[model samples]
Structures are given as structure tokens and as C-alpha cells.
Target: MTTSILTSFIIIISFIVKRIQADCQNNTLTETTFVYRRVCYFANWAAKRYDNISRLTPEDIDPFLCTHINFAFAKVLESLIIAPYEEDDLKGWTANSKGMYERILKLKETNPDLRVLLSVGGWTHASRGFNEVSKTAANIKNFVKNSVKFLRENKFDGLDLDWEYPGAKDQGAEPHSKTGYTKLVKKLSRVFKREAERTGQEKLLLTCATAAARHRIEAGYEVEEVCKYFDFVSVMTYDYHGSWDGKTGHNSPLYAMRNERKKFREWNINSSMLVWEELGCPKEKLNIGLSAYGRAFSLFGETGMSNGKPVTKKKSSIGIKASAAEAGKYTREAGVLAYYEICELLQNNPSNRVFWHQQMSVPYVSSKTLWIGFDNIRSVTLKMQFLKEHGYGGVIIWSLDLDDKTGTVCNEGPFPIFNAAKRELLILPDHLINKDKKCSDDNITITIEHLHSKMTKIKQSKNSK
Candidate 1:
């Protein structure tokens, strides 16, 4: 009970509080708060299907889960105007009479922070519309003007140009497509900026979904020049290899395999990100794309073998002799299956075997003659870790409909993959501190020291009495 002992106790408590505050400031012992974008694309076709198992309408979307939701496949017409690819997307005969566009905007009522952008020109629409529109300055001007007007009227936050490739031959692009692509983006950027200033509204975001492969990047993009005009770029990192190759391969490998073929070594997310970074794209302006679907193929060589095994050509196959497997129970695509469908296939069949590749950080399933490669929680976690370490801006889910809408597939809960990305990628406030657990011994020592000091004070007071 002496003044000196009391003073020492106060000093010790002050030191402990100061230490905790310092650790919090340094982001070592606690969560740190910061804003980051999580973009999810909602395909318009999802509303057309009426079946509960296969259909995923705008109402199924979790508005608060993403910072931006892109309404996909608003086509670019030959007349240089942006319009809905399907009439059903904009009009309905029901009593509600509200189409996909209106339904998506209604989500904002629940999550006011959400931003929706109209995504024009998907893989199918890009082949002709993009090439024609970007061919001349007049066409580009008309497209930009109509695009802004369309977005504003539809209650969209901005526009996302989903041109598959500008100079790629497969897409029917002309030789001048490279230069035309850059010119188009530049013009759109200028127009968007000017429109925002004149109307006294917030600057509308301008972004694009770009190719991830090295060859595609080289042939299609004036990478450095094109990236400067956009707010951000979503790199479509999935679909590296599929049934078209006549061989089984991972849909989206995180890293290139050690024994990969020379030609296929650069077909990976790592290589794509590196190529974009080397091309002068800022890390903060790049969002890596994730697929909620897997590429399915019928195996040729040894059935149930590990990935990267040699394959013999199957009869009646298309491009590369590998026959496309049957459509999934849900996705109903010949060579693809949604993540939920894949999970169901794995769970229902006890004979199906799963294999993981450490080098690529991906997983595959093989049973009898069917082989499928896909991303799961394990692979997604690794990708998120890489994104965090490499300073990437965020992630973009290709189409939210493909994920398990019902919580029955993965058993991890609704939107399992999306939830994993949000938890791993974002620097959320009030996250648990692992360092606090590590400091358990120190905490025990401090508690014991305080108890001893109290006992000493009590003994001293007794002696004085």
C-alpha cells in the first residue's frame, strides 16, 4: 500500500495499453480496415429459366456481398448502339412486368452501397459488333454516346466492355483491330469524364474484361496503352484448357506445371498476371477472374490416373479428338459443369476419385472415362493468398449464377466460394487476432505478476495495521 508500489502498478498498466495500441496501428495483432472492390457478374439469361434447380434470378443475388454487380451480355449492335441481347431481359408479360435490369437495380434498395454496371459484348457478341464499331471514329463516338445514355436510363452505375479480343483471328477481327481497340477505349474514357463533369454527377466507372492468356494478350491488346484509360481490368483467368484440346487439364491453374509442354507453360493465372504487370498495368487496377464452373472431358489413356497424363484421341470428337462429356445435371453444358453440379457429382458417386496437384494448386476428379478439372476451396484459398501478397486490387466472379445458390452442394453455406474470397481477400475490421493467442504466455505472466504485487500490498498493509 506504499505510494511507490501503487505508482509502479499504474506504470505497468499504462505500458500494456500502449503496447496494444501500437500493435493495432501496425496491423500486427488485430484487423485493419480498408476498402477493396469485390465485383460479381450476373448473367441476364439466368432469369429466362423457370426451373428452381437450374434458374437463378436477380433476387437470388446477395446484394451486400459485392461492391459491384455487372449485368452481363448487353450486346453491341451493328448500328453502334448498346442494347439488350434478348428482349426478355428488358420486358416481361407478368404482373410485375419488371425484367432482369429492373430487378437487379431493386437490389440497391437493400444494399445502398452496391453499384451495377452493364457489361456489353461477351464472347459470342464480340466477334462482329466490336470489330465493326471500333473500325472508325464516327462509329466509336456513336457507340460511346449511346452507351452512356443507355447506362444512365437503365439505372446502371457504368459500363464494362467485354470485348473478347480485338485482334484475334478467331473472333473475326480485322488486322487493324489492335489500333482500333485502343482508340475506342481512349474515346470512351474522354467521353465518360466529360459527361460526368457537365452533369455534376460522379465520374462513371469504365472497365473491361480482358483475355488472360499470353498469346491472346500479345495479339489482342496494346496492353500498356489500353490499360491507362480504364478504372480497372478483369482478367478472365479461367478456361485455359478444356475438351477442345483432346486432353485433360486444369481449368484455371494457379501455377504452370513443372512438366508442362513448352507451348502450354504460359497458360496459367501467374503468367497472365505477370504479363499484365510487365505491360505497365498497375497492380491496383487488375482484378483476377474466377470461374464457378469446371471444364469436363472424356479421358483417353489410363482412366482414373492423375492429371497431365498422355491421352489418345477418342472417336467422333471435335477439334482435338477429345469427346465432350455429357451435360451436367444442372449446368446442362456438354463440356462444362457448374461448381455446384461438380460437388453433387462428387458426393453422389462413391467410386469417383479426386486428385490434387501441388504444383498447379488445383484439383481434378476422374471416374471410369470421365475426367473434370475444377477449382475448389483449397485452390481458391491459395489464389486469394497470392492476390493478397502480390497487392492485386480484387477478384471478379465470372457469373454468380454458376455458384451454389441453394447451400446444398458444398455444405459450406450459400455462396461458399464467394464467402471464402470475401473473408480471405478483404481486410475486414474486427477480425480475430492470432497474435493474441500467441501472447498467451505473456498474458499469464502479467496476471501472475499483478497478483503477487497485490499480495505484497495486502501484507504491507497488515504489517502497518
Candidate 2:
């Protein structure tokens, strides 16, 4: 009896090992099958011109964007954030006090199926607007009422609030208040959601952009409350390491490890997805962030160290810089630079590695005298796999404007990472899918409940239109 039990245990162990290998292999196949959803980031009329002047019009927008694209946001200002006397403070942008209704109407007419939303707040504009609007019931109601009118007049399908952060204090903003922000979001959700249903419009899409780091959430955002109000949230997961830190690394990495001895953690995709999930957000409503531009940095000099020390008389301390377009030369001089337009650097020596934190799945690179860490197609694909495995809502890029256009890699333009995702993941609508005998699992239902739930919402919104 004893001999038989031991033999059976050995067989079971072998079977488990085989199964683990098979699972890993299957995951590999899935990773290759990544398809990124599309989002176009247009902040205001100025951003809109970025596309038009680039000769990218409605017809051109279709190729790069999925049916659903986000019209970045409309900003509202409080006296505290922007001093009235400051020259060119948030200049050359549409104002909430202006007639955005007309602008929205124009957008609606252009792409009826396109989900037009009013994204509120941005990086530099994270004024105390969120805090003020979210603090009181009266303020929340007033904002919601005006927003609904804007939606109705402009024919926007929903509202996208681009609150750069709720708790993190901005340059012009006050400190964080965990409960105040949550209450505000909750009130907005209740009002907007209720109104949408009452009016028989497809459920209004409530969404926000959340910070990628876990600390941000803990510091200010009540993730659970925010998620409750939002249909989904985009994780601004890029910028893991850049000039901000004196190191170089990939902005976005798939399986990044901080230390050599630890297991790799896919921060850009898997970890970001898990961060929200662990925060009690439904995986279906979690979206990942991507960047079209790459970060660039240079190596200064070698010192006492021969191979890796400062040699030249150049400053021992590190300095950071980004490419600048000399006003009139965007397309010609930009050289398709990402964060910093260092086309000149790409001309000399284009590549270097910062270090990949195996435990975090992040990588950084340095060149010349600058260090940059950002995501590329390879890193994006890894993150997409995490999205598929975790069944997150979808993926989002920082701004569609930065997509690679020149045949940098094959015929695929700047949006290669996202394009690859669309082909593999089936984020493209069925109508858009090229019906061919190419796909092996063509007939399989991609719907796994939360998968493409946003698509369903979009369709319902379209039907309402």
C-alpha cells in the first residue's frame, strides 16, 4: 500500500509540472494575440488643430482611432489655481466660460458614433477645481447640471473627467482630502447616472485617469468610491522613470524586476491592472495607459571609473533636457521624438538601457548625457497580454498626436504598438474586423462578460444617437 501511494504522488507531481509548462506556453500564445483598443486624445480646439494641420482629418482619424475616441478635456478655472494677472497662464485654450457647446456640436456632427465627452482637468491644469467641485453637494449639482446641458447641446454621448489627481496637490491646488473627493465623485455619478437613465440615453460613461503608482491611490484617492462612480478608469501607467530620477529605464516595461534576485513583476501592464483590482475595482473597468513618444537621455562623462566613470570636464552631476521644435518645424525637425524630441541623438547613437527592475517589469535607457525610460511596442505587447489575462476594460495611450507616422518600423506608423494590439486582441468591432480565413479562433466569442463592456456601452450610446 505504501509503495503504491508514493508512486501515485510522483505521478501527480509530474502531471502538475507538465500542466504548468502548458499554461506558460498558452500564455505566450495569448501574449502574441494582443490587440489594443484605440483612443484619440484631443484636449481642446488647439489640440484639434494639431491633427488638422498635420493633415490628419476625420478620414485620417479613422485609421488610427477605434470607433471610440476621447476628446481630451475641457478645463474650468478657479481664481486660486490661475492667478488672474499671470500672462499666458493656460492660454490659447477653450474656456469653460466659453461656448464649448458649439464646439461639441461640431464634433458630434463629424462623427456621430464617436463618443464625445468633456474630460475635465489635465497635468498643468489640475487646479483646485476638483477639490471645490467635489467638496459640496451644491457645487457638484451645479457642475453636473451644466455638464448635462453641454452634453445635450453638443450631442456628446457622455462625460470623461480628466482629474489629473484628486488628492495630490497641484501647483495651484490645495492639499488632498480623501473623503471630499470621493463624496464629489459619488455625487456626480449619482446625478449623471440617474439623469442618463431618466432621459433614456445609454448609461452615461463616467471615467477618470488614475495615477499608476500605488502610493498615489493610498495618498489621496478613495479608489473604491471613485470606481463606484466611474464606468472605468485609465491608469496613467507610463513615466515610471525618466529625468525625474537620475537613472535611465524604459517608460513602460512588461516584466520588470527591481532587483536581480526577485521574481519579475510586470508593472506597466499586469501590476497596474492588479493595483486597481487590489483597490477593489472590477477588472472590466480597468484600462492601461501607453505612450507614443519615447524618453531620451545621454551619458555625460566617465570619472575615476574607467568603463563607467566621468572622464570629460563636463559636470559630474546629471542634467536633463528634451527636444525643442524651433517653432515652425514640427513635421520636419521633430524627428518623431517622444517626450523629448532628440532626433539629433537618434542620429548619433539611438539606444541604451537604464536597467530593468525584474520585480517591477520596468526598463530604462540612457544615451549621450540624458537618461530616459519609456515603453515601446515590445513593452506594450507584454502589457496587452496582462490586460487580456486579467480581462481589463481596454488600453489607452497618452495622446494620439504622438503616434509614429514615418515608416519607422515597416509600414506601421507611430501607433504600431496599438495597431498590433487591435489585430491580436480583437478590440476592433466585429464590423471592422477583416473577415478572412486567417484567424484560427475566428468564431470564438471574445465576450467574457467584462470584456468589451465599454464597447457595449458605446454601441448603446450609438443606438441612442
Candidate 3:
């Protein structure tokens, strides 16, 4: 009798093990089947803004929401080595003086599959440091060694080079910046691959944050050569127009306006993606950038205009016009507002009206002189659909900090825009899988629950017998 009981227990244990293995295999297959990357950039400066509820710390991040989290703007030091952009906030101490790096690394406990990358350089960090370091083969070699060490020491899965523009003269890049940029990536890829082989680990991912504009792309990147070394290229598709343009326009429009002038037609997201594809960059390696903030401008004439209608700029207003509209309760920025802040303004204030452009698939809000163009859930859904249909790899958010982290503003839920994108992109199309077998988050959750209950029943039956 005891032997029979032991046999039954062993069988049960085997069954459980088989079930776990099968589930894991299914998950692995799912990931492999649908190759999409949802990359989120966490701005280190956010930790400094303690008073702002939108201020996000490393601990506030939801690891499961993204496939990869890039810690933004790690600086290139004078020694030509990579370092934390905000050392005190990123690797330094808390009020209790605990290391912040520890807190970020600990997030893997919540989602072991999540990849954390250290992103060096940004719009503000576009200094000559990268140029100087990439000048010579020896310099590139040393930089790569130090970079690999820095990433490994901090438990980072990879490195993301965020050089604003390699050959942009205004950005202080060197004359040989274009060639140097390509060489730097090539050397880094070689070294990273060799190191991975030596350490018996997966090859480290190497990616770059590239420009969206055609002029910037021509000035900086040798798309074919540079792309060969990168695991993926994140195209900054937003900021097509801002205070710099001295006019009201979409911060990130998915499609070109129906009546857009020829010169401005190339400014939209679709044009940029097509340009990159034509230049030999694979669609699978391109991740379109999405902004969580809007570009606000003050209009000179009409108070209300339909979406895509060219509004005249206030004469001589070179910078962002101060909004007569009430200050956002949180973001408080003069020229830009977070999606959360925008949602609050549109929802609570009935006078602030919204206009949707079907042609561009974007939205803008106007009240008096205040004009703001931004993306919300609907726009993001459309963009995601565009991405999936076009076979683009995925989407990358300019930041995780600017989104409605608490889910209080949009009322759609936390990371509402991002959630919409993920729901659309991550799910495999029905044609890709068995027609009758539907795969979705909801279906997966139900399956797991059913398995758990069945296991419980099996144990109960064993005891009764």
C-alpha cells in the first residue's frame, strides 16, 4: 500500500514537472514567434524632481510592461570612458545612502526576462567627447573595453549609443564624425561578440538612437554600414516641429498631412521610416520612437482650427509662447506637457478642445492661443497598427517618466499609450498561428488558472484514493 502511494506521488510530481516544462516551452515559442521589442527609456533626471508626482525613481518602473528598459543619458567622461550621467541619482545614494544602482538591478527579481541597457549620450549630452573617443582605432578599442566593463559591473544587458548626430556641425561633432561613428559601432560589436564567446554568455546587444530628419540622417549616418553592427536602430521620429519651428504642428505625426507642402512632407514618421528602409536599414531592425510629451505653441490669430490646418505663428515669437491656459498641475513646463498633464487639461477644462486628423492619425488641442499636439491611446493604437502592418520591429518611448504612472490622469490605466501599443504589437496575427487557437493575455491568464485548479484537484483525488 505504501509503495502504491509512493508511486502515485512520484507520478504526480512528474506530471507537475512536465506541465511546467510545457508552459515554459510555450512561452519561449511565443517570444520567438513574435519578434517585437518594446523598449522604454527611463530618464535619470526624473529622480531629481522630488516634488513632481510625475517624478519617477528606478523603483517606480514596471519591468513587465517593457521588454527592455534603457537607463538614459549616461555621459562620456573626459577620459573617454562611459559613466553614469547622473552618478548621484543612478549609482550613488538614497536618503539612507543605499546605492540606486542596486535598486534598478533588483527590478530583475520582478521580471527576469527584462533587459536593462545603459544608454550613453542624449540631446543635451551631445558634446565632443564621443567624437574624441571614436577618432582612432586605439581610442575605440579602449572605449569599448571600458564600456563592456561598465555594463557588466552594473549588470546591464547591453549598451545604447545615443549620439545626437555624428556629423552635425552645430552639435560640435568632429569633421570625421560620420566615419568615426560607423567605426565605433563596428569595433564595439567585434569586442562585445568576442567577450560573449569568452564568457560563455549571449552576445551583448548594441543599438543606437538615430535621427529622424532626412538632413540629419544624410549628415550623420551611413545607414547600411552602421546598421550592420547594430542589433536595432531606434529612430527618433518625434519632435518634427516644436517651438523651434515657430508654428503649431504635430510633435509626432504617423502620416503626412493630405495638404502638406512638399518640403514638409518628409517630416512625418512614415517618410523617415521609408527613407531608412530605402537606405538599406532592415525594417525588422528599426524601432520607431514615440513621444509621451507634446509640443506646445502659442498661436497669433485664430483661436480654433481643425487638425492639419496651418495656423499662423505669432509674429516675432521665436520661443514657446507662455500658455494663457492654466498651468499643468504636474508637468509645469512652458513649451511641453506630459500626456498625463494634457489629459488633465482636456478632461477637466471643457473649453480646451481637441482636433483629430484622420490623414496623419494624430491629435492636437487648442484653447485661445495655446496649441498642443500629442499622442494619446487612440493615436498610439493607430501607430502600433501601422508598425505591425509594415513589419517594423517595435516602438520605443522617449520616456517612461512622462506617462501617467499612477493611471489617474487618462483614466485608461497606467502607461495607457504604451499598453495600447503592446496589446497591438505583441499579439501574433491570427494567420501566423492556428486559426482556432487564439493567443492573448486574457487567454493565457485563464489557461494558467485552469492548470492551477486541475493540479489542486489531482492532489485531492490522490488523498481520497
Candidate 4:
């Protein structure tokens, strides 16, 4: 009887605490004050194999929004909608149809300031769609006209084109894609800007997700002409070196360690910035890229890799899931590879060769199995600080879905990385106030007045309900 009574008391206390917290949240002026903080998460609905928009609840999208998070781009690459003469080319078409626009509109209604945009073209897919869509004046006109109608009908804030490349022509694609690409963007901008005026709608933002490798841009797209059509470009700076590169290095090196001196001399952030700036694009229009996840690699087996550890045993399998455990035996790992919230190497032993790179601001693990590289909170913070120093527009996350939804990674939620970037870069007026420092009573009075106004609004809402 005594235990039951204690339990009842605890439950009552919990209820009361919850009620107080809700009341405070409703009346807090900070919660009500609306400000447009510019940060965008690239959400790929069709590309994801498991996480689908239909399975997602309103809660799934809520954490991504607040006064600070003003924008989200639901990537609807048109290439996915088209058949690419491949078997899986039709794989995602059904799961990702035109209904994405409606789902995004629902998202916008939930949060007044939150806006959604559809992206077209992506790397490794639809290389030909760009050429097919832009090769002729008629095709360009149709794409632009239909896109304007689609945006208006669906109420999207803008559109982002993410064509991987135009000239390099990977796989079995066409050449002169760069030439046609420039004309296509020029044509689209002309129509989009004009339609906004005729309809009296607010300005529509035009942006692109571009390649980061120096050679890719110089060979593929005409950077100068492409910048003219876009308000800003998101440089995919990650994936610089991966298992595919056949070498061990950070996936996205901030300073290009392999060729740092040469990078400084010719191709680097400064040169990339110059390319866009010279094309008449404003500096503020450029946004860098960040990746929430990391890449893993496996090294050779039967090579006396078990240096001196027991867990350094080779895994009997491949893929990211087995990388950590399989790497346990070959204890001679060089870099740290982060998987979800667990690092197998770190858990087994901290003194292992695999460790964080302080200078490049990334993590990597070198093991007998293979050398792998990835990112962590420290690297993310460094990237954020870099953005602030450069005063570039903002940062773009490669994805929003892969983050651990349970909020376990880095002691923050899946989107914490992006949220940190906003706080450090945007400099909101509220955050500027030093909460620790004492302020005059006059400022306190003003804050109280605002809180009182919010209280009134809450009371009005309660009475209506």
C-alpha cells in the first residue's frame, strides 16, 4: 500500500510538471516571435529505400521546423520520373509520383513560414534527361512552362536543379551537354521571373546543387553561365575520396590534403568563389555542403593485420553493418569510422590507430581490413566555424533522413548538425542577447510586455477552443 501511494504521488507530480511546461511554452515570447532563418535540408523521398513520406507522421517533419528552420527542399529529381533504360530506372517512379508537391504543401501549412522546393537532376542518375530536356528550344520551353505551372499549382517556393554534370559525360551519355544546359537554364530563368510578375506572386528562389571536385566542374558544366541562372549553388564538397577512389583518405577534405599546396595555388574555395563571383553571382548567394553520414572501407585479409588486439579479427561479411565488427580482429586500423551512434573500434579500444583527424576536421579508421573515413561532431563544428569566417550565405546538408531519429548521435537529434550551423551562422537577434549578463529593468519590462501579449493570444485561443 505504501509503494502504490508513492507511485500515485509521482504520477500526480509528473502531470503537474507537464502542465506547467506546456503553459510556459505557450506564453513564452521567444516561441511566438517569428523570424526567417535560412537553412535547408535536402530530403530525398523517392531515393530512400525505406523511409517514405506516407509512413512519416507530422512529428517526423516538426523537429525540422521552428522559427530558425525556414526552408526544406523535398528533392523530386525529374530523372527519377523518367525511365533511364535501366531496370531500376522504373523502380522509384511509383513510390515517388507527382503527389510529393501536395505532401510538401501540407508541411508548409503546418508551419506558416516553412517553404518547400522541388529539385531536378542528381548525380549517378538521369545524365541523359538533362540533354534530352535541353537539346532543343521546344523542349526547353515545355520544361520551363510546365515547371512554372507545377510550382504555381502546387505552391512551391522555388525550384533547385541538381544536374551532376553536362560535359564530362559519364556512362553512355551525350556530349555538348554543357552548351545545351546553359541555354536551358537561361530560358527557364526568363520564364520563371516573368511569370512571377504576371501572377503577382512573391519572388521564387532559383538554386542548384553543383559538383565540388575541381576537374568535374571545369570539364562538365560552364560554371560562369550556370551561376547566372541560379541565386545560389550548393557545392557537394563531400565524397571527395571514397572506397571508389581506391585510396585511403577523408571523404570530404576541407583543405584537399592530397594536393594542398597545389589546391592553394589554383583550385580551392577561393577559386570556386571567384568563378561564381566573376559570373556576377553575389558572395552571399553561395552555400557550402555538409554530410550527416560517413563512408566505410575494408582492407586486405590474411596480412598479419591483427597487430596485437583480440577484436582485430576479420569479419565473415561485407557491407557497412559488418565493417565495425569485422574490423575488430585486424586491430591495425588507421582511421575512425562512425556507424550510426557506435564506433566499433572506439568501443573495443581507444588507443587503436584509427582516430580523428584534427587538421582536416574529419574521422578515419585504418585497419587490416581497409582504411575508412567519415565525419563527426568535431568536424561539423569546424565546418560551421569555416562558414562563419567566410560569411557565405549558408550551409546545405546532403540529407535529412539518415540521421538517427532517436537523437542519440552526438548527443543531439538527427538534425542537430544543421541546427548548430544556423545558430552559429545566422546570428538571430534573440541569441545575440547575453542571457548570463544582467540587463536594465527597461529591457526586462519590454520582454515582459511581449510575454504578456503572447499570454493574451493563448487565452484567446483557449476561450475559442
- Tens digits of lDDT, candidate 4, 223-334: 6667778767777767665555433445665653443455433233434555555555555667777665555555545232333423334232112222222321222222
C-alpha lDDT score of every prediction, in listed order = 0.81, 0.55, 0.80, 0.54
Model 3 bad stretches (over 4 Å): 1-31, 94-96, 301-329, 431-465
lDDT tens digits, residue span 169-268, model 1: 9888888888999999999999999999999987788999999988889898988888999999999999998877766777898999886788888889
Q: Total clashing residue pairs per candidate?
A: 0, 51, 0, 22
Better of 2 and 3 by lDDT: 3
lDDT of 3 by residue, 1-465 (tens): 554565576567657666766776686566645547999998877777766568888888787889988888688975879876666744465466645566676789999988888889998889558988888988888999999998888788999999998989899898889999999999999999999999998778999899999988999999999899999999999999876665567789999876567888898889999999999999989999999888777665453333546444432222233333334556666678888888887888897788787778888886666788899888998888888788888889978889888787688888887788778886776665543333354555565566566667767787998
TM-score of 1: 0.81
* Weakest 10 consecutive residues of candidate 3 by summed lDDT: 315-324
For every candidate structure, what is the RMSD over all alpha carbons to the true structure, in angstroms? 8.5, 15.6, 10.8, 16.3
Structure candidate 3, residue pairs in collision: none
- Candidate 1, run of 10 with poorest lDDT: 312-321
Candidate 4 Cα deviation (angstroms), residue 426: 3.4
Task: Give the CA lDDT, 0 to 100, for residue 191 in model 2.
Answer: 78
Determine the backbone clash count of candidate 3: 0
Candidate 1 Cα outliers beyond 4 Å, as residue runs: 1-33, 301-321, 428-465
What's the true lDDT of residue 362 in model 4? Answer: 65
